[model samples]
Target: MRTDVLHAVRLARLDLTLIGRNTTVLVNVLLLPLLMAWFLTESVGDVEIAGVDGRLFVLTGMPGLIPGFAVFVNLVNSFTARREELVLKRLRGGQPSAAAVLGGSALGALALYLGQVALVAVWAGRSGGLVPANVPLLLLAAVLGVVLFCLLAAAFSGITPNAELAQVTVLPVLLVMLLGAPIAFPADTLPGVLGTVSHLLPATPLVEIMRTAFLGGDHVSGDGAALSMAGQWLTALPSFAVLLIWIAVAGVLARWLFRWEPRRG
Candidate 1:
């Protein structure tokens, strides 16, 4: 047990070092999302939405966006690169279980994503008066976002033939996840059936959870109703269920589709 943990930790450290050395990955996974958040926050400056500051609303969406790029898009490329290089195959041949191997490879990305989230949270708190109403719920949403996106990345990588193809493959998922969620605007304003369907997207629940945690209300119930902290926690239950379901679905797909070696030409 201890050996497995140690192996996973070592793999995570190595992956983090590699991520630091890769300029493109660092830029895409770390810099781009933060910049996007900053830009959006500034654009929405001092505006109010459903009684919550617009900047806070934008900041709450970072958990959704950060993991999408940091873990999902980045790991798809990471897994593809490692597979083509036979790194994944070599690791699989060793004592670490498949879960440990994949989890360790993904841990670094999760750490980076969390760091970006922290930066956004601190910035929002200081500048936008975004004090989270339910800190635990906020953390839960972030954790769930990381796990689901990591699994989705692993599953998606199975269909990605090469590192170059990863850039193209990630776009559709990003579009669906980001656009389908309440990022740039509130989900309740998305119009009729589209609004209803948006709630089903994997990113939606995570963002909803964060909004409830930070704003004490959600885009769905947009009448400026400030939920008590306990009420906010209760409101997050449905989103929690949605995230858990997606996590299970992603886990199944990853187990069935993830490839340790590159496909034969």
Candidate 2:
């Protein structure tokens, strides 16, 4: 919050340049959405999932996916790697508080997410796609999702011994998205257990947020009206809360757990 602290975060974020970072950012922001949308736009063409036309189901699944890719790929990995390298350690030991280091990383990720969203919206609109029904809610979901993932990513990095393993730390989250969630199939077609499980995952609400936005519906993906409302709030609030908690927990853990110079053992 202080001027000096803000300056430090800015400096730290600026130093996060890597070759694969560029490629990962590009693919997440550009190619993933296009490929998903294209799959939706095209016919199912004999494809069938959960007894429904595969393409239709996949289309319904695409909106939610935007959030998942945004979090795990766009924010989570980079934040963790930054922390794993003791970037946070160095910053905290210096003039910057832990907050500043995390804040700067968050701002960087948000900038990327917004930029990518803008590009997607512009290109999709010019191509005749529909805008989301509720812009405010969708944006809220996107931002909240980023905030949660950022802290969780940073916290998880504490368990990582080196920067190279940050990818492994974040890998399971990505795997969950690819496996049981909407990204895997149309919401309607997922079996009872998978549907139930997907609804429970952290990424579920994020995908639901995008799905509701694009499909022009509420994030109420269930039978109970109250339940749907609860689900929506559950996804957003907890997703955001867990991350801040993780930040606190991780900040403390890093005091002991994080090693600046690699251990020889």
**Best by TM-score, which number?**
1
lDDT of each: 0.82, 0.56
Runs with alpha carbons beyond 4 Å of true place in candidate 2: 8-63, 66-70, 73-86, 126-128, 184-189, 222-264
lDDT of 2 by residue, 191-265 (tens): 888767776666666666654554453334422122243444453454345434544664565455544333345
What's the lDDT for residue 7 in model 1? 85
Best by lDDT: 1
- Cα lDDT tens digits, model 1, 173-199, are 888876788876767787999998887
Q: How does each model score on TM-score?
A: 0.94, 0.68
lDDT of 2 at 29: 49
